[model samples]
Each structure stands twice: as C-alpha cells, then as structure tokens.
Target: MIVRPLALCLTLLLAGAAAAGDIRIKDLVEFDGVRGNDLVGYGLVVGLNGTGDGLRNSPFTEEIMANILERLGVNVSGEQFRPRNVAAVLVTASLPPFARTGSRIDVTVSAIGDAKSLLGGTLVMTPLNAADGQIYAVAQGAVIAGGASAEGDGARVVQGVPTAGAIPAGAWVEREIAFDFAAMQQLRLALRSPDFTTAERIERAVNRAFGRSVARMEDAGTVVLDIAATGARSPAHALSRVENITVEPQRKARVVVDQRAGTIVMGADVRISRVAVSQGNLTLRIDERPLAVQPNPFSPGETVVVPRTDARLEEETGTGLAELAGGTSLSEVVAGLNALGVSPRDMIDILKSIKAAGALHAEFIVR
Candidate 1:
C-alpha cells in the first residue's frame, strides 16, 4: 500500500525535476501594487417564496427594507411590515488591478439574516465600499445560487449552500483607485513563498533576461528591480519582458500528516536517519447482555433481571522491532516504513516517534 504511493510521488518528483530548468517570473513572484482590492457592501435581496428572513426575528431586515422604500420616494415612515419575501445580504467583490470606469466585475451575495435561501432572488442596487470607507462600485443583479433546497411538512433537504450566490459581471466599476504603475522608477517583486535561494535565483534570472544587473535581491522574499536600468520606456514595458523569465524554486523538506483522515504527504526532499521502529496495537472488546430470571409462573414472588458481559483481549502478531538503514531519498524512507505492514494511522504514530527520537531528517507537521 505504501510502496505504491511513494512510487507515484517519486515519479512525479522526477518529472518535476526534469522540467526545473526555468519557470515564468510571473508565476514565481508578485509585482508590488499589481493586486486586487476587496470591496464589500450591505444589500437586500427580494423575490423569495416565503424563505426570506422573518421580519420579527431579524429586525434589521425590516429597518433596511424601510430605508430602501423611503429612499425610493415611498412614504412609509411608521408603517409595520411582516413580509417574508425580502432578505438582508452582504455583497462582496474584488476590484481587479487597473480597473476602469464602466468595467464589470463579479460579485458574491451572502445572507446575513435568518433567510432560508437566496435562490431566485434579485439584488437591488447596493453600493460597495472599500476599506477606506468610500463607495467604489455598485452591484445589482439577479443572484444565481449554486445550490437548491426542498422542504416538506416534516423534512428538509439541501445541496451546496442556498444562502449564498454569485453574479458574473454583476458590479459596474464607478471609480478607479489611484495608482501609478506606469511612472514608477523602481518595482519590487514579492515572492509568494519566501526563500533565499529562490529569491537569489529570480534576481539572477531577471538580470540574465535583460543582459544587465537590473534586478537585485533585497531580502529572502523581495527582489528590487531597477526599471531605469532596463532601458525601457515605462515600468510596464520592463515588467513585460521580465515576467516570462523562469527560475526553479527551492523549498524545505517537509512531511505533513492529517491524522483524522489517515493521510500522509511527503516532499521529495524528505530524508530519514538510521533507526529502528516497532509497530503494534492492543485492542480490547466488550459485549453486554442482560439475562432475565423468572420463578415458576404460578408461585412467583417477582421476576428478576441479571446483567452479564463478555470481555476479550487480543494482540496482533508478526510485528516487531525492525531496523532501517539511513534513507537518503523519500522513496527509500517510505519503502522502509511500508515494510512494517501497518495502516496509515499506525504509520503516523511511528513517524511521530521517529521525529521525537531525532531520526527523521524532515520537518514533521500534524493536522
């Protein structure tokens, strides 16, 4: 069982190593300021079949509904409403980099009140605000929930999440965030996974692509780019030429285990030192059975109940202390462990014990 997975991982590692010559720079790092901004807003969804929020239970829904009605020139200041066809929701979207006015972006709507579902509902115009407390975009469209729900008198069924949905091209961009990506003299590339070796390789790759020392490593995670030295008209032009340059990334050896799922994942760089491991488990079982006692039917004082239990203990055999030589590769380590013939759960315990004994040469992580 373990040999197959380790063999698969070994094959994948070898395939990846063969293609480690170059990776696109854009895939390796993030260009500073070229990112999206999260926008959120409060909104209302109408047109539901009595599955919306109960006004009595969620008073805020009533408040927002009344506010919306009043804003639309309907004078219902003191009127009470017990409608079950409207829901209060939160609208969220991301303003992509270089978004212009009139550009459309997708938005997600989630129920904030005790609404049963947001399906078959239309969102009224809602203003999305940024972290700076300024309205950035307005989202309004029909919500297409990814789930469905059905309920009878005594039972209910749901698939996916009915209280949340999305609308593609739902929000129209009204204003653009101020950023000077073109006029920037220097640009910084932030590595997605910060590593000194990877960052240095990226710096070297970028310089080699430009045929000059245009990029330099600032830290383990950041690489500074001299846009002026690239002799490009703008920083955008300089970045276009640099992003295609690929460099192989470096990562630390790691082994992660999910105990609840009995899953173990190892990196190609994982290794093991010489050690011996013993694997076994003791299992105990108990069965309860109640015995009934009765006197002769005609002359019975009373019927009596007696308790009885059966207990048994068993230990697995054929598993004992097995000595393993030093494993310089992930496959060897996995093959060594697989020789014990234990389940994944038992493998987790053995790996933990090996790590505790300082015989595991990789970082051990448990989830």
Candidate 2:
C-alpha cells in the first residue's frame, strides 16, 4: 500500500492548529452538582419467540414468573409451569438533571439469564430504584434488540448482542431530586481533564465576563464560582453566563496508539528529539511432506512412510538507519516519521523504541 505522507502531515498540522483555538467553559468543565443519576431494576421480559430462558436452568426466572402471576391474583402456588416465552432481565436508565415528574426517559434492557435472544420481547412494569433505595421511575415497553439471531438443530448464528436491547421513551419519572439549584450561594466547576493552566484560565474568563472577581481556581481540577457576586438572579442564571465564556485551555503532549487498528494519534504538543531508527521484518517458513513407500509389485509385503520437511528464515529489505530531525511542530514530527517509509503498525514500534531511547518527549500509550 502506498503511504500518503502529505495527507498525514496535513492532518497533524490541522490538529495542532485546532488545539490553539479558544473553547467555551462549558465544554471544558462540568458543574459539580449538575449531573445524572443511574437507576437500575430487576424485571422480566415476555413475549419472546421461543428464545426465553430455560426455567430449569434459570430458577430465578421461574421464581419471578410465579411472583408476577400471584401479584395478578392468579394462584400458581405449587403449580408446575414451564414457559419458553419469558426471561429475567435487568433494566437500566439514567435520570437526567432537572427531570420533572411524569417526564419520559429511555431505558436499556439486558437479559441476565441464558436466554438465546431478547428479540421481540416486552418488558413488564419494572420499578427502577436509585442508590438511596427509592423508586424513581417505572419502565415497561417493547424492546428493540440490537441484533438478530437465526438457529437450527445443527447450527446457529448471532450478530451483535441479541440479549440486550433498548426502548426509546420507555419510562416515566415518578420523583424528583431534592436539590434546589436556585438557592445555591456557590457552585464548583469540575474540570473533565484537570490542568492548572486550564483551571486558571477558566477562573479568569468567568471573572472577566462578570467584570469582577467572582470566580477562583481552587485547584488544578476545580474552579469555584460566587453566585451572589455575579449579580445574577439565581445560580442557574450565573452559570448560564459563566459557562458561555471562552478561554484557551492547556493540554499535555500525548501519543495514543491503538494496536488492534494500527492507529496512532498524537496531541499538538507532542515533541521529539533528533533520533536515528532502523526497522526490519523476519519471516520463517516451514513445509512438511509425508511420502508413502510401498514394496515392489507382487514382492515384499510391508509399506513404509517417510517424512520430509523444509524450513527457511528470510529477512525483508528495510529502510536503513534513517535520521529524524528534532521537530518543533506536529507536522514536522509526522513528516520526519513518514520519511522512513513504514506502515502504521511498523511506525508504532519505531515510536516505542524512540520513547525508550529518551528521544520522544511525550507520554506513549498503547491500547
């Protein structure tokens, strides 16, 4: 495959330029108390096309089925029942901030039993609870399985996760969190990626927007905002004004490598010192042939077998020791590396060796 050095250089150059632009405070930090809550519940999924769990294999499924029947005033005590259309499932949903009662939210359903698939299943009325053990919402809807499955007596094929599914707008909120956003006197902004320079910039940006010192950098990861000093109506109003302020955020030099995909990503600040590198590949080949030797016609009785093998070691001609000049910019670094005429997978190894030699001045991460 032909390697496009110019395209790679341009991509790195553009990435460096993009990082220099000012970003909004909202994108760099999160409001401390403004977040979503996770809700989970154990429930049952029904109406499957014979893909439900085996009652004998999953005794929990049988127990839950009996409980549902009894709750519906149907006497199932000591009754032997085997159903192939029901499965036990775990329902999960996120309660968004400021969600009001009667509001609808989406939910995910995952089969916890040995059900082959959850396709065409409907979740029963399941009460979702939060960490406080309080019922927050109820979930019940038709499941949209992520994949499909086909099976027969001899073979089976499944794509994606057929046992997990999702339902859009499948739950109604029954309670609201007790936090009063309007009554807050102060609010903290938590940085998604902590950086002292970024936090200071955010503090300055917010204070500049309010024309006063209403924001302070508590640490590398936190910036506190004084709602009363902003002269805004409430904490919500103050945050609305502060979050829109723009500031240039600082980032560290980092090189990320995804080995499976042969992808290499480098931040704008990544740097490298002048270094020489050599790369090559070795291939080992082996072949085996079994020969059967038989006695002459109408002569001796036994047959003999002989084994033959061939093996060879070969080395591919690679680019000799190449010099990578120290780079002051991302484009230069990418160009220098590309000049070696290697594929991305090979480039990853070169980078690793460069880091080990103390020539690569950035964090090297391999996934």
Candidate 3:
C-alpha cells in the first residue's frame, strides 16, 4: 500500500505543470578569493565533575596542566598533582572572510585525550592558528555539549556524542587577512556544478544586464568578469551588482536509488526507451521432523532415533512480459513503470535490468 501511494505521488509530480525557476547568481557560484580559513589550537578544558581524563593514562594532559600553572605564576615544578576535573581538548574554528579584529566567532571543542565527557567543562584561553602558523583568534568559554552520558558499576548509556561540544561566539579575532578586494581588476565566479550550458547562460545574463560584454565564460566551471567594463566605483560594487543577476541553470538527467530504504529519485529529464519487463518471486521451503523409536517394557533392548526432512521449491505466478513503449515525457515513463504493479524495490531491480539492456537513458546512481 505504501509503495503504491508513493508511486501515485511521483506520477502526479511528473504530470504537474510547474517548472524550475531562475536562481540568483550568488546562490549558483562562489566568488574567487572570498573564502574562510580553518583555525585550530590545542587547549585544556576544566571544571568537569570527575569525568575528565585520567592523569595516569594521559601524560600529555599532566604536562599541559603544568605549563598552564607556570604561565599563571604558580610554582609547581616539583609537586605532583592529580586532577580528575580537567581534560585536554583541541579547539577548532573557521575565520570567516572579511572578519576583522575584535569580531567573535564560534568554536568546536573536542577531547583529544581519554576523557569520559566534556559536558560541563570550560575551555581555557587557547590561541588558534591558521595554516600559515600565525595566531588569528583566541577561544575561551563554557562548552555546550550536544549529548550526555551516565555510568554505573556495570553499565553505561551514552546518547549522541558526549566528548565533543561547541561554544557559540566564543573566539575573538586578533588578526586580519590582507586581501585587497577593492583594488582587484577582475573577479571570477566558480560554478558549484560544472556545466557548459549553465556557464554560457550566466555569461549572457551578466552581459545583458550591463548592456555590454563584461562577463565571459572562461570554461565550463568558471566565468571571468571585467570590473572596469561595468564602470562601478570598485570591484566590490561590480560584484554586488553582478551577484544579483538571475539565470536559469541546466542540469543533467539523473536517477538515484537507495536500496536500503527502497527509494528512487529521478530528474524530470530522465527517459526510458521501449522495453519489456517480467518479475516474479521464487521461494524454497525446507522442513525437518525427527522421529524417536522406543523399546516396549520388558521386551526389547535399546531405543532408536530417526530423522526426516522435506524440502521443495515453489514459484509464484507474477506479471509476465510487460511491454513498455518509449516515453516522450517523464509522466509517460513513470506511468509505464507503475503499470507493472511492482514495489519500489522491485522497480529498482527492473531499472537496473533495463539499463543493462541499453533502454534506460540517464545517469544511474545506486546507494
């Protein structure tokens, strides 16, 4: 019943009159030289309720603790300390483009040692460095863990991940990336999905908006824009204007199937040639019945056991040799498939067979 309902919905979707609309240029492409940088730092999280790393098992945790105490002007050079309320963690954050000093960003804290949990811990002031080995931000705040855990003598229950957490707006930016966006003579737009037709459409749309040939398609994946031709005050102004232009993007026909969930998704342009399909199920039955023989009282000597088995093969009569004509539209294709009266899982197998026979004409993806 569920399969039939799903098929009906898909048929209706194909038969609908609605069509895909145009998309803004900003949503379709990424601007060159405008991206984020990854920043990471090793730090310590404290104030856990006996759920931190064991000092005996994690020597690095003890070493970092000693360093932190030394930095705070506390002399613990020779004294031994064992603390169950601290954990070693790695703090990570992304420095967003155009981020300036004093701006705060979010950071993720993950336990790097054998810590039980990071539920109620507070991250120490940790300096986050970028790929260039320069400090860009400092993170320090109370962690908001996404999950929780509890343990008894013999059992433990954990829901979600208990050792990883995040701090919102917890890192303060200290350095700025030196990128002169205003002085750039040109900018490039990189398509998220490379297509020659989409790239050409974007080029034409941009030039039409300015009434001049300002943007040119460099390749299927890139479009180069001449900022001077737009006559904007700066490169930023030129980009701001170009990013608002809308264009319809073209995509390839594709079919994706998830065998585990018995689901299939097809693009509107997917088509199938004339084909014949037959489906049936064959099942084997096996049964075992062991018999026991016993001696009569005051009569025979010993008891005997015997075994017996019955096995047979059965095949159910199914839809035989269904012919599907070549479909001119998506609705016809789906209608023909549904006419076989098969479930989605069975339809997936049929599609695979059709593709093997060179009848299905779309990119097939199985997951």
TM-scores for every candidate against the unseen true structure: 0.92, 0.92, 0.89
Per-residue lDDT tens digits for candidate 3, residues 71-162, read 99998898989989999999999999999999999999999889989999999999999999999999999999989999999999999998
lDDT of each: 0.86, 0.89, 0.89
Query: Cα lDDT for residue 139, model 3?
Result: 98
Q: Mind sharing the TM-score for model 2?
A: 0.92
Task: Using TM-score as the measure, name the better of candidate 2 and candidate 3.
Answer: 2
lDDT of 2 at 311: 75
**Can you write out model 2's per-residue Cα lDDT over 205-319, one digit (the tens) per residue?**
8887888999999999999998899999889888888888999989989898876666788889889999999887766677878799899999968998899887776777876
Give the C-alpha lDDT of model 3.
Answer: 0.89
lDDT of 1 at 153: 98
Give per-residue CA lDDT, model 1, range 1-367, as digits (tens).
0122211111111201212356788998999999999999999999998899999889999998889999999988879778889999999999999999999999999999999999999999999999999989999999999899999999999999999999999999998999978888899999998999999999888888889899999999999999999999999899889898878888778888876566788877888889998865555667889899999979948888999888776665755789888987777887888787776567777889999999998888889
Clashing residue pairs found in predicted model 3: none
Error of 3 at 111 (Å): 1.8
